[model samples]
Target: MEETLHWQPAATHTELLAGPVAEAVRALADDDVHVAAIDPGLADTAAFCEKYGVALDESANCVIVAGKRGGEVRYAACMVLATMRADVNGVIRKRLDVRKSSFAPMAEAVELTGMEYGGITPLGLPADWPILVDSNVASHNRVVIGSGVRRSKLAVSGALLAGLKGAEVLDLATGA
Candidate 1:
């Protein structure tokens, strides 16, 4: 699912991105992506949308999940529309092939991803980690996602996100 989207220069909001995220944005050099700074305190999707005048339907949430197998923990990031929630115990656990899966602790998510708790994005995730994008999310023309920090958000084409390495767009979301 691909659609044309309007994007601008992400470099304009470099100050809002975390170190790794900023570097990743520069590396991509996507003219079809843009970043905008906002109050870190309002980084949460609902607040960010309300405060910044962005529609909730156009905002995506990146949630880190911890899957355990034989005492070893593996992580995956799930991207879904703010209007829905990921099917973690069902679709995700099955996809990950793990015994069980749960949302990663805030500390662990931030530490491992080198991003803020309320601002984790799929863009700069570890290469080994999978980025599960819900089908509906992949079909959106444009979406607002975290910038690896709470102070900013990235506006990008849904097709661009689905194209990221290790990204798998599937039916991973359910009604909230």
Candidate 2:
């Protein structure tokens, strides 16, 4: 799958990424991270993998979840393989210590992360938001994820993602 796409150094192709995502790539300064341009209309996981010949398990999805308690709301990014769903109502709700937790609205997620709706990635999320990585994803050798823009995707080592500043690898996936 990696050889199927024309991969370029993410740090050098900032134009293909949303502002915050590009900045995050630059900050990481990791040469192994790569990016590939894709048709914006096919950015969704199913379409992308089918069109690009990538396997479902090789791609990770980043879901933005909002947890609310009283009048306070907190947001977090959950990274799980496309083959599994995040344990939102169970693990995440308890982790956030919130009474109610659900996927954040599209508009709220886009606005808060400064990333496009289908292109939100854990790499550049707000520093305060904890990035919950599914243990399966964290153990994978490589995985593709959104690049903060629908027109491109980032390819990175699972280990690198798990090592991000605020990332926490956990048993956050179910139905695998």
Which window of ten consecutive residues has the lowest lDDT sum in model 1?
A: 1-10
* lDDT tens readout by residue for model 2, 41-148: 999999999989899999999999998888899998999999999999999988888988999999999999999989999988899999999999999999999999
By summed lDDT, which 10 consecutive residues of candidate 2 come out lowest? Answer: 1-10
Question: Which number leads on lDDT?
Answer: 2
Against the unseen true structure, what C-alpha lDDT does each candidate score?
Answer: 0.87, 0.93
lDDT of 2: 0.93
- Would you give me the overall lDDT of model 1? 0.87
State which candidate has the highest TM-score: 2
Clashing pairs in 1: none
